[model samples]
Target chain A: MNKRELIRRTAIEIIAEEGYYNTKVQIIAEQAEIAVGTVYNYFSNKEEILNYIFKVEFDKRLDILKRLKVEAISFKEKLNLFLEEHFQELETNPATTSVLVQESQLPRKHSLKAVDDFINELPELLAEMIESAKKKKEIRDVNSSLIANAIFYTIRGMASKVVLNEHYNFDQTKEELMNLLWCGIKN
Target chain B: MNKRELIRRTAIEIIAEEGYYNTKVQIIAEQAEIAVGTVYNYFSNKEEILNYIFKVEFDKRLDILKRLKVEAISFKEKLNLFLEEHFQELETNPATTSVLVQESQLPRKHSLKAVDDFINELPELLAEMIESAKKKKEIRDVNSSLIANAIFYTIRGMASKVVLNEHYNFDQTKEELMNLLWCGIKN
Candidate 1:
């Protein structure tokens, strides 16, 4: 892997275990097998490195959603595919999920710029898709941004559990969530 | 209000405006119109004070949920009544909701014990209700704990918005959410 990519992956692991406040640039450099000076070349400070992590992750999801928007599949198919990708990514990289869910909740002084952007933009992106779905009568007229936000939190709450708990089965989690999103729990 | 309640109210306001790390006991004491030592007499430390806030808030909701369990109402009615109370509380006391949602998300060093309990216990409480509802066949075969967690996050996400925005109508917000929750967005 490239030096910058190596540093990024190393930081995720250390930050996941030690947390952002406890993590140091020197430790990340040593763990990545690079000089601290070289680390500084890629990231201005620890916060910058952390922000880079969120920016990369959020951007990946946004790209996938954007790509799905143009596909011939129904909005339901799009959502299912996106959720599958998102959850599987979290399931495989629990460390990154842990860091993403946790660090984004820090107070402003410690909060990352990208984290704030994700908080604002990810829902908007989803809302856009929901809006289009409503227009096509693919889904009922549920408020777009509101439903988007609900879905966002549901994923976060579930992903947080996936990182800490082992009992969550993949198909089960997705099916239950999809049921609530598509057909409410009202018997 | 009593002296202890005065301190709690003042602390919530200050902590809401300034992030938790930025708020000090002395400031809370000054704002509460009490002596610093007097504040200590009631609470051991700032963390304890924060924990008390979460403990009281979580217990209030738990009480309502427990009370609802014994009522003759269906799980659907029980959930609606509980959500109305929960959202109305947040709407009226935006400051408290702001603190509860934001503070509970802080890292371990800064995390409050009661916040942890609220996060862990609230979902379980809801799961118990869902489990009982399932037994009665009042709801579908959806996983109890899974739906409970989903509802928990959905509330958190929506409550997070209520604190920051003023455009959300009480009826609109509740209706949209109850619709997605009671009867999902499927056309």
Candidate 2:
């Protein structure tokens, strides 16, 4: 991995173990096997490192979603693919997922705006997908942004359950969520 | 009005303004116009103050839901009444709502377990409502816990939107959500 990625992975491990409030930049530097000054070369402080971690992960997901948007697949297929990939990513990186989910809820400090920007991108991407699906008549004419926000929070809530409750089965939960979104709760 | 309530209100103001990590016990004591020792007399520390804030707010909602459960109202009506009150509470106390929503996402710190317990109560209450509705054939026979979680997250997502985006209309969004839940999203 590159230096930036190395630093981030190290930070995620530490932050996940010691809550973000307890984590320090020097510790991350030591864990990454880099000098303290070298860490500064990439990230100015601990919050920036945290922000970078979220930004990198979110950017990767955005890239995949953008690519899927152009594919000649039905909206349902696209959504399923996205959900599957999203859950799989979380399952593999529980530590990072924990940090991202928890830290995003922190107060809107000016310092965390970069992280907030990255966090906000998910709903915007979901909104785009909904709008595209609406144009193609694949889904009902609903409020795309509202639906997007709902979908984003649904996934977030599921992720929180998966992380907090050991009994939560990721695959089964994903299938149930898809069914609810596609067919909904009403009989 | 009481001493504990005074401390909690003061903590909410500080925590809401400065975020949880940045707020100190001394500051909360000063704002509450009580001695630091007196603050500890009411609670152990800052975390307890925060937990009390959430517990007080959640208890009120849970009490209403429990009372509604025994009434002769339909499940849909119960659900609508519960949601209307929920949104109205958030609207009237945006600062406390912000703190509750944001702080609940913090890492699983032992100090915050009371807050976590209070936070988990909502989903459990929702699951009870869903299971009851299913028994009465008010809703479909589906995974009650999953649907409960979905509805909880949907409301959470809407709450976050109302708090973050200035243009979001709480009443209209609540209506859209009720429509989406009552009549499934499928066309």
Candidate 3:
């Protein structure tokens, strides 16, 4: 791994182990097996490191969505693929999931611009997919932005459950979520 | 307002103005025009006060739902009433909404039990409504808990948007949300 990736992975592990407030840059530097100054060279402060972690994860999702856009697949297929990948990402890295969920709840202080951009980007991508679906007649006419927000929040709620509830059956929950989104609660 | 109510309202205002971490019990006492000792006489500490803010707000919601249960209305009507009231509450008290949302995101160091109870109770109440709707054939049979959780998260997303975006039209958003929930997204 490059120095930046090395620092980010180390920061995630440390923040996950010790809550973000308790984590310090020095601790991350030690964990990454680098000098504190070297860590600073990569990230100005601890918050930047946290921001970078989110950016990296978000970028991965965005990349998948971008590729899915070119593939010969239905919007439902794209959404299902996205949800599966999202849940799988969290399931594999429970600690990163915890940090992401927890940090998001805190006040927006450090790297506010980066954080805001990342937050906006997710919904924007989802909205684009919804628009694509609408144009292709895969879905009924609706406010794509609102629907996108609803789907985004549902995914978030699922992720929180995955982290907070140890007994949470991810596969079952994912199946139920897909069924609910595709079919909804209408009789 | 009673002394308890006075303190609770004051705490909400203060916490909303300056986030939960920045808020101190003494500041709350001062704002309420009560002695710090008197504040403690009613509550243990700052966290309890924060918990009380959530409990008070949640209790109001629960009470409304309980009453809605006996009313001669369809399940859809009850759900709409609940969402309308929920959105109105946030619109009227944006500050308290801010405190509630921000504090919920923070690490659970204080009043974990109270926080957990509040979180669980909301989805539980929504689940109850879904169950009622299903039994009455007002809505199709689906997993009540999952549906309830989805509704709960959607409302949360809306609340966050209301706080973040000044131009957000509450009535329109509420209308769109009901329509989405009532009719599936399928073409």
iRMSD per model? Answer: 3.2, 4.0, 3.5
Off by over 4 Å in 3: A21-27, A70-72, A104-114, A184-187, B14-31, B70-72, B104-114, B135-137, B184-187
Encode model 3's per-residue lDDT on A54-104: one tens digit a residue.
888888878887887777998888888988888888888877887887754
Ranking by DockQ: 1, 3, 2
For candidate 1, lDDT tens digit of each residue in B1-187? Answer: 9888888889899989997888999999999888999999999888888888888898989889889989998888888898898888877887888788676446565667787787788889999988888888777777888888888888877877766667666557777777777664222
lDDT of 2 by residue, B65-123 (tens): 88888889888888789889988999899789889767545544454655556557877
How many clashes would you count in candidate 3? 0
Q: Candidate 1, overall lDDT?
A: 0.81
Sort the predicted structures by TM-score, highest score first. Answer: 1, 3, 2
DockQ of each: 0.57, 0.34, 0.38
Off by over 4 Å in 2: A13-31, A98-111, A184-187, B6-40, B44-47, B94-114, B184-187
lDDT of 3 at B163: 73
Best-first order by lDDT: 1, 2, 3
- Candidate 1 off by > 4 Å: A104-108, A185-187, B104-107, B184-187
Give per-residue lDDT, candidate 3, residue B164. 71
Compared with the true structure, all predictions reach lDDT values of: 0.81, 0.78, 0.77
**For model 1, what is the error of residue A179's alpha carbon versus the real structure, in angstroms, after optimal superposition?**
1.5
Candidate 1 pairs with clashing backbones: A184-B184
lDDT of 1 at B109: 57
